[model samples]
Target: MRADRLVSLVLLLRQHGRLSATALARELEVSTRTVLRDIEALSAAGVPVYAERGRHGGFVLLPGFRTELTGLNPDEALALLVAGSRRGAQAFGLGSALASAMLKVVDALPESYRATAAGAAERLLIDPETDLLSRRLAAEEVPDAIAAEVLRAVFAGHKLRIHYAAAADASPEWRTVDPIGLVTVRDRGYLLATRSGADRTYRLSRILAAEELPEPAQRPDRVDLDRAWQERSTRFRSGGDQVTVLLRLDPARREELAGTALAVHAEKRDTDGWLRMEASFQDGRHAVWALWQLGLAAEALDPPWLRTALHDRATALATRYGTPS
Candidate 1:
């Protein structure tokens, strides 16, 4: 761990030119004394590290000094390159930083592996703006200033005031929340926060405006964001006015139905090679809509209302097409 810290210290100086012991301690999550000791050690090891004693003085390396510490294997280099290719980083306002980091990684890589990794990365595509069907993926617009403030509050462990536009509401509402962390999933960003001790997840794009408050956040010093997110997701999936539907579908169409259903309760294949599944939906309309998308491949087996709805839809389609007897 100390070795990693020392490398990080060197990299930080290399990137920023000069940084004070206080700033170094904060960045490395150590004490000023520890930073001083590390600085002494680096200088002693003939690293050409020098310190200046003045109001603006700190540690600086000799001009044009660089380290040859690129110890990453080919696989590691490729993984970093692939990660840099993702659009998810754009949601957090870290696109430039990710680009800069990737450039540094490529420059530091072994000559033989560098061109190979770059060529392989070019062949992979992720989350294209438009698919073959011409359907576009939703990319929310988060203002740079708003994203910066949200990040500051999350990293600094402070409360945040945000003007949020809830989907059901026409106007944005202002609320002060204790930010736990920031998460980017797929191509969207969300702020995991709490208001009056109740957990809340704010879609970053829906946040019309934000302010990093001066007050300290009221949250546990240590939080498991993944577990918390999972708990909330579970509650959301189960808490609605859910309705279950029994379906008799072709085995090939099972995935089509399951994908649209909120939850699949059970599935079994009959002797005739048909699949019967029980699935949950938000309500009757939701169940009917999903089954309708499957067309003739799926049939509603139970809940008279669902079957009636499908029959009505089918009848309307037949009437519109005017099929011959």
Candidate 2:
């Protein structure tokens, strides 16, 4: 939808020659802040749009420049179609709008490329629900009413009050935050905000309720969401209680062990062909669970407590089956 709005901004400038941010916002039916952000995006993308400082002066596009669907190459057009087909757009409540935009795109393209591009895009699959191993990648569901409140708050730059359940065992509690933006990673939606000047990220699915406050959000006018997400992700990964364990694993299952570990500190093949490895996990429980899956194929060497726990579990299992219950 932002893409469509940006294109409309360009078209308006091309048709009307010059328009103030307020005027553009009025025409586009959005806030002047949104219009300003769009203008910045356009400039960054190398569109020849400039502003004049005088009271009467506004934003103007350079003379003799034209925008048409022909500007997009076959690959570019196909890429757009493929992206439109993804479920990410739907996460932001823009699925139908994106579908409409894609239809317009196909209609605008030359007949020769239109059918070919559409057909090619249909042939390609992006982000299928089930992966190669037949495992379903469940998309976290956020109620439409909750998502709508958050969206309105993000766009309006207002403080947000949310009843959030921090954990499954904990009851939902109300908290107020200054919202920065919404981020979706692997089909999971997150609201990036600041609470009492400290960064916070909340899962959309966990929000029991949301209310947009009338007060303006205490946040910067501009934000680099990608950078923000990276910083938070780094801190989250490095923070928390980490557990390290040394193990002996079947060479074939070494990869499987490493895949679930937070970090694989070291690994080597033993003379007997087993893999001697040191791995770290989010917690001791995480380490235990990952290693338990391999059964006899994986052995925890270090951490006497972990080895004892696994031994106890295996003994209990063997005893259960050794004689009829």
Q: In candidate 2, how many clashes are counted?
A: 0
Question: What is the alpha-carbon lDDT for the whole of candidate 1?
Answer: 0.80
- Candidate 1 — which residues are off by over 4 angstroms? 1-85, 130-134, 323-325
Candidate 1 lDDT over 128-246, as tens digits, reads 99878998878877887898799889878999999998773668999999999876676788899999999899999999899998999999999898898888767777877888889
lDDT (CA) for every model shown?
A: 0.80, 0.82
For candidate 2, the per-residue lDDT at 59 reads 98
Each candidate's root-mean-square deviation in Å?
12.4, 14.1
Most TM-score-accurate candidate: 1
Candidate 2, lDDT over the whole model: 0.82
Q: Residue 65 CA error for candidate 2 (Å)? A: 30
Q: Could you give me the TM-score of model 1 versus the true structure?
A: 0.68
